[model samples]
Target chain A: MPTDTADPRYDYALRPPRLPQPVDESLASAPIDLDVRLEMYRKLHLLRQWSKRAHDLFLQNLVKGTTHLSLGQEAVAAAFSSAMRPDDYTFATYRGHAHSLSRGMDPGEALAELLGRKNGVLGGKGGSMHLTDVTRGMMGSYAIIGAHLCIANGAAWSAQMRGTGQVAVCFFGDGTTNIGAFHEALNMAKIWNLPVVFVCENNLYMEYTPIDLVTAVPRPAADRAPAYGLEPIVVDGNDPDAVYLVAREAIERARRGEGPSLIEAQTYRHGGHSRADPGKYRPQSEVEAWKARDPIPMYHDRLLKLGTPEATLTGIERQVAEVVDAATEFAKNGPEPGLEDLLVNVWADGGAEWRN
Target chain B: MAELSYREAVAYGIAQEMRRDPRLVMLGEDIAAAGGVFKTTVGLLEEFGPDRVRDTPISEQAIIGAAMGAAMTGIPVIAELMFSDFIAVTWDMIANEIAKTRYMTNGQVTLPLVIRTANGGGVRFGAQHSQSVENWCMMIPGLKVVAPATPTDVVGLMAASVRDPDPVIFFEHKALMATSEEIPDGEIVDTLGTARIRREGTDLTIAALAAMVPRALEAAEMLAADGISAEVIDVRSLVPLDTRTILQSVAKTGRFYTVEENPRVLGWGAELVSIVSHEAFWDLDGPCVRITTPHIPLPAASSLEDLAIPSVQKIYETVKRTIGGAP
Candidate 1:
């Protein structure tokens, strides 16, 4: 099961074996209505299809900027979005299309943003790496590796001081764990017992280098929670139900003033780091191996086995395709921002003297 | 009218503002229990409690960052950095986050954040503690930089700064903290971008900031004895500079002398000269003069520090030379 070589077979065997059976029997006992589960699955599928189309558009030069496609990281975003309240603040890294889309951003606006059109959520000012819609509680997606952690912490601290029940969630890659701001933010959040959730999507690779080479710790990224005086949870990121159950508990824990939790979702990116990378550094077999545990197919099979009809699944796929198609078309016809917009919003009316 | 020190005036202004607005809070190292290293925040914690008056860890970055967070959430935060030199530690938050957030957010958000720090060289605090860095904040947009010279000006300017919709770097001269002046009671000074004529004359116009305002007035009195009429103007704010008043004075007098405690080269004095030269070049009878510190750090010895910063004698000589009275 060693992932030391470029061979596909060894990498396939290296992936953790599938769970012996469904581990969510206790969670299932609560009896979530089938309609809710189906809706969540449909949304998750839409994010996946939208990201896949983004990857394709990036390769075909239809999209102007580089994209951090979350091909194999859909369930975590879907589950976290489903479990959190609308008013709760969320910040994510550059690989944040799925996160933004799941948090109620209009798919047309999201696609327009990725396409770098004037109709983007940031009015084309923030492209793929910096999509922000504060109105929707999506604080922003930062390009600076770990800077958003402090921003999220500040937001959470403000929320705590204001006596707001809203919690802040920050999403980052495993690479962010090596940064100073990450440690500083975690220490502050712990000391203040601020309502925040640090979700690390451990996709095993930070850009081209694997996590093992970059990270000092052997366990999942969240395992360092003991040092921060917080409980850590590791879940099968590819399993939607597992992600949903753990995210629910974490969100509730934060909402109840119990401080923060570090949830490390053991996942993978089925594509390259960005549109420019073909992922040649990763062995073909490793890529193929993760493909078997692809969250989309896994969730599709689980839904069918759990009494979802084939016609219903087909209908969801068709709906997702239409949504993505319409969004792409909307972006294709979106207007470009005027030159005057560049000077707009630089300062308040009275503060314009500084600009001169 | 009651006589109050500049430091006392700052404290009273903060106290009055805090009393007026419950959302106003203060944070800094040694600002709570120790009442700040300079005692400017004495009795604030007792009056306002820990939540409103906080003593933060020695980390300047954290102090400024926390203030930024509080300000972003609708709280007006008055953060003290102890000394202006220590502002470098939190420059990233000040320059990048606090100063830029309002503009970057497209004016949808306003950062009513005030960072009060002491600067100047007469206290013999040496190179590290006595540098005047107001020009640094002046270079940044979306920030209002103010340097108040008098006790009344400090009270009024501080209140205006607290109410400003943008981030403000309020510089108080360490030497002037103990200087006393008669301040008006029960009235608030609201105009921040306007300059005040401390002394009126026709021979030369002297523009000064912070501690130099008194030195300019002293020089004006000396110049008046020699039949060299000198007008003194206190530039209370730098960013929203009252260029109109300065140009008008320069045009009428035909001679300008800019004074500051900072090093001579590229200082605010140079900037003022440039502004006056550009705006009133036709009215200038002689080259614009500037009285400023030498291009070196303030030394530790009191005598050496006195030599480093511009003094009343130095300002008088500059004014005399500008008015053709140097012989």
Candidate 2:
């Protein structure tokens, strides 16, 4: 009620209706099997718990640098990652730990990177914001807003040019949709028929500023998609099954050479934008509401109601704790990079001219 | 050997590289159907078709970023900005994304990417379009800056740049694009960390890059008229600089002077002065002089623009003064 729906500044009129979650269809009728469902649940749970641990480390001053975690938005990462092929490429925003984890990047290496160790990915060259794993198809995580859109387009273009059926998915927040690259990349993708999916994680905030205050349209992905001559989809990002089904459609469409699509995953970040932010700008009642819809417990209760054994659910939780524990211990003991490692990978021919 | 202009040599070099490697592609505004505003990419679209020879929209950041992504994903791309002036829009992608991708990824990516753009300020293209940004790029690490003045060096350096495993910013002088030279038979790819001693002398070592090379050669001719022998060295590649050749020349001459189209303060020539001072300072007979553009933006008017940049006359004066004696 605080925001006026009739305001011309906000594009409430252009947005599509929100997709419902926990549809009438039974769990047996879902696309994924019971085993995959449990795995998705386990990954989402692990992501939530891992984010908590990372926050604790930041607070304890153990972590040297700040990090952006998708604290409340784990299901989107789990669902879309499970939907796509392993060879498919993903370009993520700064809050990409969950997405990287979903793409099978080892937690040990990620933690080591956080610890700035020799055993870390990039050998401590790229800390929290710049984690990359080409082997796992998480090409790179960009910290700049709207910087990765065209990069994703080029990857998808390469796939089409090389006769590879792989897809490229760019994960950004609602704030990034306002930038110029969003329009330019989408127009080019439509013209070239690139196999890319532009997924906007609609967390309703560009840092502390509300999306409505800045964005012309309420649903940027849908409104902007039509401008670029494509139909866009919206899904409940917190619901893994709903998100999974929507992502599957988009991925398969791109794989079939039907060109790119945009999907706005309506989700929320439970924590602040970064470690330094307290998220004081958000209304208190809204935060409590999203917290009640937290994906981990919601999915757990839904699975238990669908005849899943309590022991099976408990065992999944235990496994996740073990993985997080091992990752932390490994990262703590990892070797610090030597001075020589600074010059590595700078050039393929030889070492670069470094300042002494 | 074939006689070719600098523009023709670039197109020919790219075509040859494309023939040798199918992964090589070109992308930039007006490069495909229009053959580039400078006509440097003429006839490429017809030969390679639109896929390999792409004409991008006027999105400098997107085009540069897309090329970096494509290069990282296993294809070699030559992304051209219409002018070096527009490179300000591409600094982030160049300095942060393309240049640092290979190193930041921990050796996971290899970017065989070359960025081509016309530089210098002879034509009256106004302040926005006229700038020699080779110095602007030289400050960044992990990038090879090549300014090819003649037709042959343009082809040779561009060919070498495409074959290089790292990112290279290949600067072609706008005023020298139509200038012709003899390109040798077979492939003429030269080593990057090498300089050409155009005219060797003992009075003063004159180092210059791109358009300045030709001016230095002219200055050498003028200095010869006055009985002053000036060694003219072409500083072809700025990064992975051929400091040894320069040091050896300065050791022999015992005096140094540098000329560039960039502003004098913190110019590319200033870097040469620093290096020569550091390595061969003891051998120097006098202080090194840097003949360059004034500390101001290039003007659009013909007279002002010409007055702003270094000329053969100024080079002559600086060389004589660095020797600190009348010839």
Which numbered prediction scores highest in DockQ against the true structure? 2
lDDT tens string, model 1, B1-327? 899888888888899899988878888889999988887888899999987887765667656766776566567889899999988877777786677655444454567889999887788889999998888888787678899988888889889999886788999889998988888879565676888889988988999998889888998898889998888999888988888888888888999888888886788778789888887899998888878888897799988988888889988776666567342
Candidate 1: where is the Cα deviation over 4 Å?
A: A1-36, A52-67, A114-116, A205-216, A219-224, A271-285, B187-189, B263-266, B269-271, B294-303, B322-327
Name the DockQ score for candidate 2: 0.55
Say which docking band candidate 1 falls in. acceptable
Best by TM-score: 2
Q: Write the per-residue lDDT of candidate 2 for residues B164-217, one digit (tens) a residue.
A: 989899998899988997878997777787888999898889998998899999
After superposition on all C-alphas, the RMSD of every candidate to the true structure, in Å, is 4.6, 3.8
Clashing pairs in 1: A8-A285
Per-candidate TM-score against the hidden true structure: 0.86, 0.95
lDDT of 2 at B28: 94
